[model samples]
Target: MSRVSDTEPCGTETAVRSTRPKDLTSRSSFGVLGTLYSAGEQGLALDAHRSLSRSTLLRLRDRRTGAFIEEFTAWADGFGEYRVRLTARARRHYAHHHACYRELYPDIDTPVPRPTDGAHGGLVDHRADRDPARNLLREADVLVLDALIRLQGGEIGRLQKPPIGRYQRGTSPEIGAMPPGLLYREAEKLANSRKPISRLLQHPDGPLVAVVEVTSLLPWAATGSIPLPALIVLTTRGRDHYESHLDSYRRAYPDLDLQLSRHTM
Candidate 1:
């Protein structure tokens, strides 16, 4: 990928016009698939931590002894196959990891009355009314999103369960059939919806935001450096899924402009 010019700072209207035809899908929150080890068992989970410092990354790897991947990948075959299945796995991961973030923004009172800094636990909770982290996340979900997209090919480097085995003779013939493209689509949807729903939950009365993913159709808009628009409409299978939603949101709130990011399928 070519670097943007130093003279032209990213996120300019002039730059937008000069760039290729815009994609409308924009995503705020990025969901990452990871493996965690507990006891002898391993599990798959989603992580909100944006980037791990080199030290933290090394520490996590050292602690696990390559066990995290084996446990998580073995949890199920569906995880690597479909985006929806991955979503389910991520939800489970979030619930489990909630404790880590919760420590920073403990709902329960402690002797220290741990400060409610948004960085630790603020982004995940939708019900907190005074969470600046929530607002910041709503504004910067794209940051999380872009990082995850760039990591598509080799982000999670760890041991994992073996690939799905061949079907048994007694099972139905179609039992193991699943299209590869389907996983990409679902991954796109999950990635796209992350920030929007987080926004809705965090700021029930605030403006609407669009979330999207990078795919083949909207290559022009996939540049990770750009600040995403208000409305995002990613392209897959040569059609835009978010078109009607965008139109409906526009009709309801014209003041909030639409932003798009297209990824060709």
Candidate 2:
């Protein structure tokens, strides 16, 4: 394995500037080194598992104290893996979801929800044969998954762009007006396009900021092992609510390069 080190002083400015758009496009996979750096952690080592592949292991440390923080691994397919030591506050948030998972699926062996798990991720059962719920849980996952596929496919500039005009909410001032039930019908059409998978984390109590933290500690996917970065799009109100609790979210999901965007309409 070959090891690449950045021993010079590390900070968010340096890290962001170092990561060129070309790097994201050219690499077969990406690691959390840049994420950690942007989070104010120093990357101690960036090692390649093989010279020819994008698989890598990154070690991070505290920039001020030089204390070891954590390690992140990215596979050649662009799927990222990492184990994080959650803080007390983060554990409190996770505890609620963990308990809910156990209550909802008693027979499932998975102890905790992971974003990559086909069944347990997003705290929802995404099987096509399963009975549909009255809630919007399934629809939310479909929306996010469709958005990711489009974003990765270069069909859109950001996640906020609606995949189709029908998906746009008429209530939004930016979208003007639309026929009644138009958005709902379009969503159903999008949902019917593919087998459902868990791609969103929903918390009944408030904004999705807490669930965002849970996703950061786990591998994210739209379907199967397809590699895509963690990205969230919210309405104007949702974005404001998320920003209001930004500090807590930051503490819970430190060292994550989560992309956030607001809906276009």
Point to the candidate with the largest lDDT.
2
Scanning candidate 1 in windows of ten residues, the lowest lDDT window is: 23-32
Report how far residue 32 has shifted in candidate 1, in Å.
20
TM-score of each: 0.20, 0.21
lDDT of each: 0.28, 0.31
Q: Point out where model 1 deviates above 4 Å.
A: 1-37, 40-130, 139-144, 148-187, 192-265
RMSD of 1: 21.9
The alpha-carbon lDDT assigned to residue 61 of candidate 2 equals: 30
- Write the residue-wise lDDT of candidate 1 on 24-93 in tens digits: 1011111112212121123322232333122233222222111011112333555431111123323333
Which residue window of length 10 is worst by lDDT in model 2? Answer: 21-30
In candidate 1, clashing pairs total: 28
* TM-score, predicted candidate 1 vs. hidden true structure: 0.20
